[model samples]
Target: MSTDRTDCLFCRIVAGDVPATVVATTDRAVAFRDIDPRAPLHVLVVPREHHPDVVALAAADPALLADVVALGRQVAEAEAGGQFRLVFNTGPEAGQSVEHVHGHVLGGTRLGWSPG
Candidate 1:
């Protein structure tokens, strides 16, 4: 795959340049344990390619976006008790610390509506 960005953290993880506790991987997406997990089953699912956020990724590659969601679902089904929430924070203000597009699979507890 042609991972474009060198500075993107998720891209680095996908390229095997950075170390992460990877739990799942597909041709277009990867899932790993979050460093600071909010839920008991908090995993981060990211695309191999670099996109600023989910909206950018969806615009750039809708198929890859589908792969990301599927990968998240696969991980959540195996790890979380079949009931999980998928979250995509678009910007830093929205809690997206990394620039690369990613989704968070959260479960193993009751999730609040506010998403704090």
Candidate 2:
């Protein structure tokens, strides 16, 4: 429970500075519901430590990066339909609102191929 990012949205959510419907949490990570859900079941999984973005994860720790992906898959499999789409929007063009690194687990319906 560190308030590393005073401006990062995910940091705020994890620190209880911002309210969110948390789904799951671990020693190093936390998963919560996205306010403006792009899909029926939209869960945002973020590391407890502040990571600028996915690129940061690639350079910081390979094992941590893998754990994030593995967790996403686990959440997807546990969904009602046992299927989900994982998304990591990079920059502004990619629709990344918060700079903090996070993965979006979208499920509960058929997802289209195009971006939203």
For each candidate, the alpha-carbon lDDT, in order, equals 0.89, 0.82
Residue runs of model 1 more than 4 Å from their true location after superposition: none
Q: List the residue pairs that clash in candidate 2.
A: none
Candidate 1 displacement at residue 6 in angstroms: 2.2
Which ten contiguous residues of candidate 2 have the minimum total lDDT? 1-10
Per-candidate TM equals: 0.93, 0.89
Give per-residue CA lDDT, model 1, range 1-116, as digits (tens). Answer: 34767878888888899999999998778999999998999999998878889998888889999999999999988987688999999999999899888999999899888857
Error of 1 at 110 (Å): 1.6
Residue-wise C-alpha lDDT for candidate 2, range 7-97, written one tens digit per residue: 8888888899989998877777788888898788899888888887899877987677787777777777777366888899899889888
Q: Which candidate is the best by TM-score?
A: 1
* Candidate closest to the true structure, highest lDDT: 1
